[model samples]
Target: MVEKSKELKEKEQKILSNKTQSIYALALLIGFCIVINIIFSFVNFKIDLTEEKRFTLTPSTVQMLNGLKDNIYVEVLLEGQFPAGFKRLQESTKDLLDQFRSESPYVQYRFFDPLALVTVAEKNNRIKDLAEDGIKPTNLRVMEENESTEKIIYPVAVVKFGSKSIPVNLLENSIAGFSDEEVLNQSINLLEYKIADAINKILRVQKPTIAITKGHGESKPIETQDLINTLSPFYNLKWISLDSMYTVPDDIKLIIMPNPSVKFDEKAKFVLDQFVMKGGDVMFLINRLKIDMDSLRNVRAEYVPIENDVNLEDMFFKYGVRIQPNLILDLECSKIPLVVGKLGTGAQTELFKWYYAPLLSSNSINPIVKNIDRVNAYWTSTVDTIKTKTDIKKTVLLSSSQYSRVQFAPVRINFEILRYDPDPSKFNKPNQPVAVLLEGKFPSLYENRVSPDMLKTLTDIKAEYKSSGDEAKILVVSYGKLINNLYNPTQSDYMPMGYNTFEKQLYGNKDFVINAIEYMFDEKGILAARAKEVKLRLLDTVKIKNERSFWQFINVLLPISLLGLGALFFNILRKRKFAS
Candidate 1:
């Protein structure tokens, strides 16, 4: 009896010790959790395991956001019942904004349904209000029960900082020749860029000023209204005449001289050359071969190439590039309406490949044109980088495809060329450069060419002339139609640049132009971030459809079967322990 009591007392003591130790462990775990929570409250930590680091923000974007002084309020108008594609876009937008908020506490966003009203009057009123706020709606066709239904959805976000707000369209409606699904995919891919661009625009101070030369036959306001609309928010755009002003305005940092039909006189040429000497950037959209498209509207359609008299050849040659007086005919080109057959009163027109309108492909890895879509060029001439004694950085920005040929000046461009099947042997020239970016110090066009007598013309303005200039950049395109907008008489509004009314598609003209300008002025690599791409991993739809029911059966039965087996084994083990 004494031995039994001693053993029982020892067992009780051991049980008490174990319980006390368990309590201490629990307390320690709770304390550690509390400390971690406090630390996390003060600091933000995140790990992105995605293959593309989709959750991570770019360094440039983070830097821009961190510099914010005021609170930014974004109203995303993509809320409501949407299809799967749009829902993906909405989730992406939210995710990107969340990343922004993580970087900067000043960023805040809210979702709103722009079409939630039931009454027609209320809906109209809401639409009017949204339009006034620059939030427009897009139409979508959804299929339900084998019936197609049209729905109006708003895919826009209005970002406001301080008193300025800019609208960012979530849908890439401007990418011509893309299906609805493709458009949405591209939009999702560009979500980060679009949002960051808006934020940068609103936060920017001291917007740069650019001049559009008007004395020559440059594009009119109506023709360039779309470009103006895109740049007005970030640039102070103006039309400066070289005829009236001897020198470019001091405030103007860049000049855009588009397609001048008339020749540049000596004074005008001198002013432009002096502008370059004064460290000014210029973008020249010139055409060497002048072929009138409107003249080919009749049945006997023939277009004879004429020499364009815009005299900037010597100036360009001195810089780096020479605009060849030849046109590029590419196998991969834009489409134009062609007459296939004649009906009683109307001609049956069909879309045919117009080799003259080459869709210039950008194989360049330059940030300005990286991953950008093809540019549509009408009567685009080829540009050659001159091998000069001076050292200048010349980069090819745009070129034709492998199956391209050069048509020398005075070549006949008639409708009959459309009927002939092009032989592959004829198109041997591969990657013909059509657009180029020239950078570095440029020698003055009048360095030794102009005489002392010509110097007297500028006697009124007493300024020392420099033979060479500081660092500058110039973008030269052998085509000018990329910036031209067509007029729609019925709507009485000008179509956006890069839009083809006949094909009802939008091209990459606007994006290229905007990106070029942005790249020029960008000191923080905002445009460089646009080259980021996230790989899309999608499952095979055919396999999913074929194995759907079998997968459903396995998913439904496997868990329950395993649970029953686990319960039986646990019960058996408990019984064995007790019985022993």
Candidate 2:
């Protein structure tokens, strides 16, 4: 009996051990499956509910990817500190590439520290054959500083499609040239486009190019580096110093002539005229007066009128604006400054008048200025609509406020001397035209000139895109300073309505620029950011002091008290059921 009992106990122990092992194994298998499901969830997650539905792609980017027969590699060559506010720029860039990766999973991306890798540096610096099957190489510069040597991101991104490879350069931020805020802002806006452009170029697709005229006192194409940087991401911007190369390239899309102080010679004029005749779009920004530092010396800032030997009267007459040999000054649209002199308060705080250069409101009706708020400009001219026979459609993109006035060329007024008291006799009307827009079919500059250059032809001062009879469209802003980039105003140096170089952001200036370009290129996606509209009204002190605090406190404490009561009840129930 003792032997049998002992054997039975041993059997019972073995059965318990087997049961425990089986239970543990089942739990592990369930836990493992749960962990694996979590892991796989992240890898193939789809944010878009309609993943199979077709999405619209930017025309250029779509073309590039479709054209690619092979693979392209994107190598980031950055390893160092960047300038102020550049971290955000890099993050935004990476975000854009991430978007592209999701769309084109085959696009290979890699990053190498060019500072540490000599082989990568050599490959980027060398001009290797990429266009045999049609490819282009791009170079990028990233600025960083070390203890001894300053390091820059000088990396080349090579795009390989079939036997062709194209390289593109990336910087902390910039298009082709360097930019200030305008360039930076634009780069941020078009990050998606830059990637598309890079990939497309690698795959060999036709890209539009912008040709900027050089010579005279036109801002050095480099100074407008900001301008070039913004546009280069979307269009291939080419600088054609008319002095050096008299010809405009065939692929040139828009020509920006901002405040050209000098005259255009016949050679230059001929090239411009021919280009326009070929359906080229032009943005004409010429100053009517010569601005000098001395002009601002007297009680009021003075200006010299511009005298052109070859007047674009005929062209402008057709388009509709006449560049009077005078400046357009407005009483309604003026910026106030701390006029250097004051009697009682010393530099008394008062609205030292500036002309009516009212901020242009974003016109949801028009695509060019769709979401653009305002461009900081002063002493802007009024544009008149010229009744033209051409079928080209025209639209006014900018204008002064209803209460505006005009200043003739010979007029003299000092912003410093305008006191709070009125001088009704000195200033003009309540409202006048500062700028207007004319769109329609434009005749060529050489149409009636003896070897006249089209670009300098100035055929339509009031109208834009005169070449495209029905298809051609032009955008004309009377003030050159709209694109001048004179200086951004700072808060201290700025008035309630002032132009501060350092302080003022491109609230609307950037939109105007990008919109103008997009309009010229006929791309509708250019202007989309909305201006901030905050409406705040402060309550009286008595209203704030009123006793709403008691009720407010009760509301806050009620939820917590309810939860505590429920917890206490649950504890009691647990004590009764399982406390034994």
Candidate 3:
């Protein structure tokens, strides 16, 4: 009996000892967790294991976000049920906003579903209201059980700071021949710039003034309304005529000379030269060959392209580039409606590839055109960089494809070309540059040519004649209508720039122009964020289809089986240790 009582006491002591050890271990684990949490709270950092580091913000973006003084409220309209692709986008947006918040406490965001829990009528009204507010909707067709259903979703966000609110379209401009996955990837890549730019615009204290040149038969306000709308929020735009003024306004940061049909007088040219001499930037959207498409309204009509003489060739040659008097014909071109045959009283019209409207793209590493989609051009000519007296850095912003040929002025244009396919073998010329950016200290075109009387006249106005300009930049585009937006008579408002009405497609003209202007005025280096690349890692559909069951078993059964085995092993160890 005494021995039995001693054994019982020994067992009780052992149980007590095991319980005490377990309690100590639990306390130590809790303390260690607390320590880790404390360390993480003070040392804010994240590890990005992505090869592209897509989660890491650029230095410029980080600096900008860190400098925010007031709160920035972002409302993301991508919520509720969506496809895997859109869900990825939404998650990416949330991650980016979270990162922004981490950098600054003033950043705040909310995910909202605009159409959630709404009746049909209410949904339509809500969509209309959002559309009026500049938030466009995208239509998604979903297939379930072989039945197709359509859903409307808004891939947009609104950034509000202080009294300003601007709608940001989250979708990047879609490019032709790009898959939906690639487009989504590109959109994700540009999320940082799009959001940050909206914030920057709202925070701007003063907008730089941009002057549009008039009195040279340039594009009217109606023709370029879309471009105006795009830039009005960021810059102060004004119309200035070189014919009336002796010099461009001192406040003007840039001059946009769009498609001037009338030749510039010597005095006007001299004024422009002086403007460039004073460190002003100029965008020359000029056409070397003039071909009027209005004359092609008749089915059997033919037109000849003539050399357009705006008379700036000499000045452009001296500046380091020359717009060749020819039009680019590319195999990769836009399509136009043509009368293929007659179908009973009505003319059978079909879309035919128009080589005259070559789709221009760029492989240049310049930020202005980096990662930009193909720019739509009509009657675009070639640009050749010439050796100048001073050192000038020239970069081609747009060029033709590998199968392209140039047709010199006096070339015939008609419906006959559309009747047959273009011979690719004959189009041997490749990569013809249509737009060139020049940066340098340019010597004035009127350096020694200015008369003494003109110099005195300049002196009287306090505008000194500069023999050599300060460091300046110039964009010489051989296509003049590159900035012209299509005018829709039905709506009476102009369509967006780069919109092809026939094809119902939007090109990259608007983005390219905005990027160019931003790059020229980019002192903060914000435009560099556009060059950020997020590699698309897509799953192999075939492999997923074939190995679906195997992965499922491995993921589900393997974990449960291992867990059960671990429990069984723990029980056996306990029995062996305490059986005695």
Q: What clash count goes with each model?
A: 1, 50, 0
lDDT of 3 by residue, 77-196 (tens): 998878888998999999999999999999999998999998999998998898887789999888778999998888999999877789998877677888998999989988998898
2 versus 3: better lDDT goes to: 3
Clashes of 1: 1
Off-target runs (Cα >4 Å) in candidate 1 are 142-148, 174-182, 297-301, 370-372, 388-391, 448-462, 488-492, 541-580
- Backbone clash pairs for candidate 3 read none
Instruction: Give per-model CA RMSD.
Output: 3.4, 12.2, 3.6
The candidate scoring highest on TM-score is: 1
Q: Scored by CA lDDT, what does every candidate get? A: 0.83, 0.53, 0.89
- The best candidate in terms of lDDT: 3
Model 3, TM vs. native: 0.88
TM-score of each: 0.89, 0.51, 0.88
Off by over 4 Å in 3: 1-29, 117-124, 142-148, 296-302, 488-491, 542-580
lDDT of 1 by residue, 1-580 (tens): 9999999899799889989999999999999999999999888898889886777777888888888888999999899777888899999999889889988899999998867766889899988988887678888898888999998888999999878999999887645455666667677767887888888888877888999989678878778888887788789998988877677778898899888888888788888888888888899998897665776675275777788979889888889889988888899888898779989999998988888888887877687785467888888888999975467899998899999999887787788887878887898988899899998888888887776766665665765566788878899998876677887657768888888888787778888898888877876767766776676566889999999998887999888999999999999999997696
Error of 1 at 187 (Å): 1.4
